[model samples]
Target: MNFLIADSFTSALARLTGQEQKQTKTAAFDLQLNPAQPGLQMHRLTNSRDPNFWSVRVNQDIRIIVHKTEASFMLAYVDHHDKAYSWADRRRIEAHPRTGAIQIVEVHERIEDTGPLFANLTVEPDAAPAQPASPPIFADLSEDALLDIGTPSDWISDILTWSEERYFQMSDRLPAEVAEALLEYAATGRLRSPELVPANPLEHPDTLRRVQTVATEDELRMALDFPWDKWSVFLHPSQREVVDADFSGPARVTGTAGTGKTIVALHRAARAVREDADARVLLTSFSRPLANALRAKLAILLADDPAKLGRVSIASFEDAASELFQLMTGRRPTFAPDDALQAAVERAIADLGYTDLAPRFVMAEWRQIVDAWNLVDLTSYAGVPRIGRRNRLGSKQREALWPVFEAMRAALAARGLVTRAQLFASVEAEFKAREEKPFTHVIVDEAQDLGVAELGMIGALASGPNALFFAGDLGQRIFQLPFSWLALGVDVRGRSSSLRINYRTSRQIREAADQLLPQKVRDVDGVEDDRTGAQSVFEGPPPTIIECADKADETRKVADYLRSAVEAGISPAEIGVFARSNDYLSRSRAAVAAAGLEGRQLTERAEDFGNCVSIGTMHLAKGLEFKAVVVMACDDEALPLQSRVDEATDEDELKEVFETERHLFYVACTRARDRLHISGVQPVSDFVADMALK
Candidate 1:
């Protein structure tokens, strides 16, 4: 008989104690190995509404509920003996009548209280009489229309009585297609069905998503090992398309905060290496910590195949470029310090007799235009396109600025020091001379944060049609200014996809974070990031925003919240505290210390955060998640720090400063999953009030 495991079983198994889980796993393996063995005590339950329900004894008190048929045995639920029986009695497994997809549905029965029907229900003299129940949200739709989306037969009538809360609570029990469709309708006020419904619903993309068919002992054991991580084993149809699609050139996957972009990048890299014996793939991100996390997930993904694991290399963009530069040049690239570069620019300006030009504007021009494009001569500098740079420089201005940049470049080269951008340029040039690229496929996670030089190098490194893939969210773009990929020769237009289902964050938190951006955010290159239909699968209490009287008051409140989060079962490692800048880093650390939990400052490659709450700047909070998050020290000067604002010399620079600051807040706040507590001193940043309204 076929052995099927449902998401419900995995979730229940995750809650079992360590010893109980071990015993239950052994029982599960035995059942899969030989279901008819007499030593395995399986009892048919007469109390269950479905005749197929049976309980398998795991221990003296634990029971495994199984729905058995002649052709298949489904491990449906698990709990203590009585609770397991009660769960089985309240549910029945069957193939949906119209869609033909299998579903385990709650039995439809009404319990009548023996006590007088209205016995404790006294009506107040001023109260009106009770009204009849309301109908389902989509009651006007035809039965065929409903069934085509895989709505269960038994749930049809009861759906008419389900309130919004009830519908949300019961969503996990419904077929994924049905739940997703209903959620989409609820979110957009429009009912949408698939363009082509599958004839065999059991084999439909939606049906096979969360339910896996375990055919071997090893497969079952692997599934049990990571019981709660179903996303690792099963890919959503939306995610699978991005992972498996072939592109003529570079391609990208974009979504909001928690939409599984990283997972797709990891799986795409794995698949490329697995399918081609000679293929080498690089799975990369912008930061070392995030790259490490991706490596860990990739290890789990390729654990069964050593060859695939060996074929994939993982690194951050900086590390990858540095290694390539060192490999070709026989020396690591050293970067000139920012102070030295600025001083060089000062001397260059003095030598060029451009005293009228503002030093800030000249520096911006050097960094964003001349240095970014590696313009070697005055003519190229005068003609280079200033994409996102705000201050427009005429030919005279460019002529005056080019010499300063030239002198600065000469100074840095004289010291044998190169900026990261220069290193990337060197690496790209070295790879261009080779016939074969370093890696056959390159998958970039958190691609939104990559700089222009890094993008140019990545584009140069991938020489094949299906070599480049990126996964990121435009709403989380904080570090880099907007630029056209077409100009860089890495255009993802017509090859872009968006994921709508958010898996890492709760509905309340996602919604609040999303309000920071427009419904549709477009890049300067005209790539539209449409987030209209995105929805979270889970719900939680809305994030709490409090404005305290002072720093001490905010710290006290934040500490209390942190302690409460721990009391509510969030481990210290699962909590993160953040501030807008390093100015407030001490305050965050103090709050964590006051709460009696050790706090560890986060770094680019910090993995040893043992039993301590993480404290870091908002910039470092990217690509991380927490059960609870505290974003404190939101005084106006702290967030959107006055220094960045003061440094803006043009309209575009000011706008960029404000937008990136808001994105910073969005990234930090959305890192929370179940609970979020944002505290600040009175006169909190305007962004805090905006989030409160959301």
Candidate 2:
């Protein structure tokens, strides 16, 4: 007899029943018939909690208890455990009548349950029912009797509550050991001492001891009286709030570049580990550099404490997922999207009936089909009408087309036709399976560059309410793709708190940068232009609008800027020149070399530099801040505005691209902490004239 593989269940079900069911109902797929194999164990899953819902293993000795009812099958409600059923357990089982005919079997001895396994064991009839309808064991006990019970000293309930409230703004429900310890402390009016508390609270301790005392008005003054020290760095109110709040939901912190987002995130992790002890906290970043930066920062912050270091895991998101995927699947995942497979899908769509649609349009059309296969609501596409004819596809047509597209996508995805979206989804599923609980609070930096699919993946990591924090600048988006946080499902239209005070740049520099994009400037809180009695040394002949003859002249002018800036007080490393195209960077690098001035072109594989002139394309400069920046070589084709174009193409698309470029330029200008130099040839990008001295 052949053993059934869990991977092939969906296709097998579709073949057997002649009906294509969605894979979202995984519980249903697990419960259906077992491909008619003889001598199979048919291990009926018994309820450790609810006895009515049962599951059986095919050709294996695994068992699971059904919890939820699906269209084709039941969902596993409880893991297999040795605990006997109680009164509450029986009611849950009796609530849902078992629908399909499944074989039932009884096993007396409990198997050696090892690893992080969930089981539902069968209870003997003679031995009590899996769950009994008995009164509470302590129901008859009087308040006096409860009070008289011997309790341990060192009750840290108040401390636990205080600590949780400080950071997460919530309370932690005490476990049995902690509750008992708290009870004893309450009766004794004194803690048993910090040493008596369990070493591992995340695994064993039910309560936490809040040792950090809140500073009163007088105490705060007294603390502030001391001379500045390293501890002074840890005393900011914002940092205090992060350290105190008991994060129960996602939180987003939007601040300027130096406003301490990373610092707050690092402190939050440390606080979580020090306070909870038993809980595991993961600090992850999108890039390896950021992750390594965070790890190094955290190491310095958490130095001299061995226990605190053990509880925190710092890694990049890709690294974490890649490791887990390798461990569980026995292979590393190749995350490249299958363009050839997508092409095949496009061809299939055209051959099947879609005549006028391109491959990308066909892919969009098939989105509905994929949604149906995933068991998502078909009505989600109510406003999006079907392709072909103005009659508009009805709900019925959507339902009809869903299975075909979903099947195709799934088959392609399995064969590696996965997109970034599919890759994120798989990683989320893997993370959920591996992690016991969602993070308390997740803080993300550079969130403005995140795509919609990436945002969805971030949402998945935050399990409880209020667990997300994001900080980003819309003006800094340089990606060819839109970084519309709103499009990624973030609401930015509402009245959100803003940080406006520019502290990093001088008022003269800020004023000059603002002049470069007059219309886009908006008021921000705390931003002030405080340049009293000081001349603007940074101010120059209003951005040199040089008229270069061709690309060769453009490169020569850029090389000139690099040499001039270096001759001044600015170090070679302090100066960065940006362009709109990579070809320009390549050509500019050669020109700089010919000019006999040291220059390096930035690339993904480039290493860090201490003091070398840097050249890069605009897109590579997002999320980076520099001391001084030189933007060069803007022209008609590179920075076209709507008024320059004569064709009747999509005006909305043009406007969107224009606005993004404007913001990108704004971001580039703002990167300069002290000085900004911009130069472009004649017929300069229309944006330059729009805000320049006319």
Tens-digit per-residue lDDT, 1-694, candidate 1: 7788877788788767779989999999999988888887999999889999999999999999988899888899999988999999889887776666677777766554677767888756747766766546765656677777778766677665666677777776666667777776676776665435467545655556556578888889877876545335556657887888989988999999988898899889889988899998888888888888888778778867877888888998889998888889889988888998889888888888878867888888778877787778998887777766776778886776677788889989999989888888888888877888998998999999988888989987877878999998888888888877888888888999999888788888988888788889987678889999899887888999999998788878898999999888777888999998887899998899889999999988757787789999998999888889999998888778889999987888889889999989999998898899998887888888888554
TM-score for all predictions?
A: 0.88, 0.52
Q: Candidate 2, overall lDDT?
A: 0.45
Candidate-wise lDDT, in order = 0.83, 0.45
lDDT of 2 by residue, 1-694 (tens): 2111211122223222112122223323333333223332233435344333434332122233332233213322222222212211332321101111111112212245574554455645676446534332233333333322211112122233332113111111222222333333333443333222334321111111111111233322222222112112232333345445553444444444333455667776777667675656667666565566666566655654766876666665566556545765788777535565576566566556756545553454543223211333445545432222223557776665554465556666666545544555565666556455455545565555554445655666655533555555544444323423443334433323233323344434455545434333231222222221211212233344455777677767766766676666566666677777765566556645654667777664435675576778776554345566777767765664344243213344445467667766665665566556666666678766654543
Reference-based lDDT, residue 411, model 1: 89
| RMSD, candidate 2, Å | 29.6
Q: Tell me how many residue pairs clash in candidate 1.
A: 0
Clashes by residue pair, model 1: none
RMSD of each: 3.7, 29.6
For model 1, state the Cα shift of residue 564 in Å.
3.3
